[model samples]
Target: MTVHNYKLTVTWSGNRGTGTSGYRDYERSHVISADGKPSIPGSSDPAFRGDATRWNPEELLLASASACHKLWYLHLCADAGIVVTAYEDHAQGTMNGDRFERIVLRPRVTIAAGDRALAMRLHHQAHAQCYIAKSVNFPIDCEPSIE
Candidate 1:
């Protein structure tokens, strides 16, 4: 079996001079950067004394799952002769205190008229094939609406 490796750098950018002197001293802001890609401004969730404007870790987790599933679904559709037009997912992740409970991927997909049953089945296949979904301990359920 072949294993692939990925790497990225996360740099803290929120030192407010004093630097973690107290509970509210330092900012929760940081930058997630990788080669040949744009940097992502990251922070803790606003509920945890973070910047509301930055992308939080919780949201990033949900996004990773959603994006992974979408890519896999599209690949399966193409291979199965299901012509896909539009695809979007409004993914929601639920957290219980500090731990994640579940993630729901509500995907709205538009396809070129074909076997609807097969199109629906591709969602299950995509779920099974998603690397991120398989890695996460929390449940990732796909609720897809094909049009």
Candidate 2:
């Protein structure tokens, strides 16, 4: 077993700064994000409170699963002697409800100019071996559109 970790930090400053007027304003930041760019992604929504355009942990977690799965697909294809010409994945995710909502990541993986049978097998191998997909409790589904 292996472990990976990252350090994240966020900060904010602006109108509604630490006040009870519902003006709740501040800048979000991250310590090791975008190479030390301390600006967390945030929406203009009054609910967001105010911040940058950095994806939150939940979204990032989903992305990690997608990325990891893609890499695993490539690895499995290589091991299986499948020559992949190209690959693409449109990964999307959403929260169920509440601040701690359950999230789901759906990845549609596409392959180009490869053996159909081998690609199909690699697709399954990728999903079965991806660490992030296996780790997350949420529903991480992959639609392999191998071509």
Candidate 3:
């Protein structure tokens, strides 16, 4: 058996005290170099009790799913000799049932200068083979387009 390793570091400082007294900022300005992805939120500010700049771990649950799927899609495209000049995903998710159970990711994909059928084929391959979609418990769907 083998296991992969991952690590994360978080730092923050502000008016120390958990109350409606001052401000607390949780900004994620730095990221790991190996993947070149911003793993944390860039700006964090706690102006009130209901509004906080620090990212709640729960929010990432959905973002991770989308990001994972996007990366997988890109890799699959490359392997199939598909050139994706531009790609973007506007993912949205909802939480309910006290369990944060519903997560929906809609990825709008764009492939540059390729046959429509070929692009469609690659998109299909990307979804069928995404590892995160296989590993997580969520209803994942996509609308891949080329423009």
Model 2, span 1-147: residue lDDT tens: 778776655433343456445443334433233555554553332345434454556556766777898789888877776767766666767664544234333444454545777777676688889887677666666666654
| C-alpha RMSD values across all candidates | 0.8, 4.1, 5.2
What TM value does model 3 have?
0.64
Query: What range of 10 consecutive residues in model 2 has the weakest lDDT sum?
Result: 24-33
lDDT of 1 by residue, 19-110 (tens): 88998999999999999999999999999999989999999999999999999999999998899999999999999999999999999999
Query: TM-score of model 1 relative to the true fold?
Result: 0.97
Maximum-lDDT candidate: 1
Q: Candidate 2: misplaced stretches above 4 Å?
A: 2-23, 31-47, 50-52, 99-114
Residue 64, candidate 1: C-alpha displacement in angstroms = 0.5
RMSD of 1: 0.8
Q: What lDDT does the true structure give each of the candidates?
A: 0.95, 0.61, 0.60
Residue pairs in collision within model 3: 45-53
Ten consecutive residues with minimal summed lDDT in candidate 3?
42-51
Best by TM-score: 1
Name the better of 2 and 3 by TM-score.
Answer: 2
Model 1 ranges off by over 4 Å: none
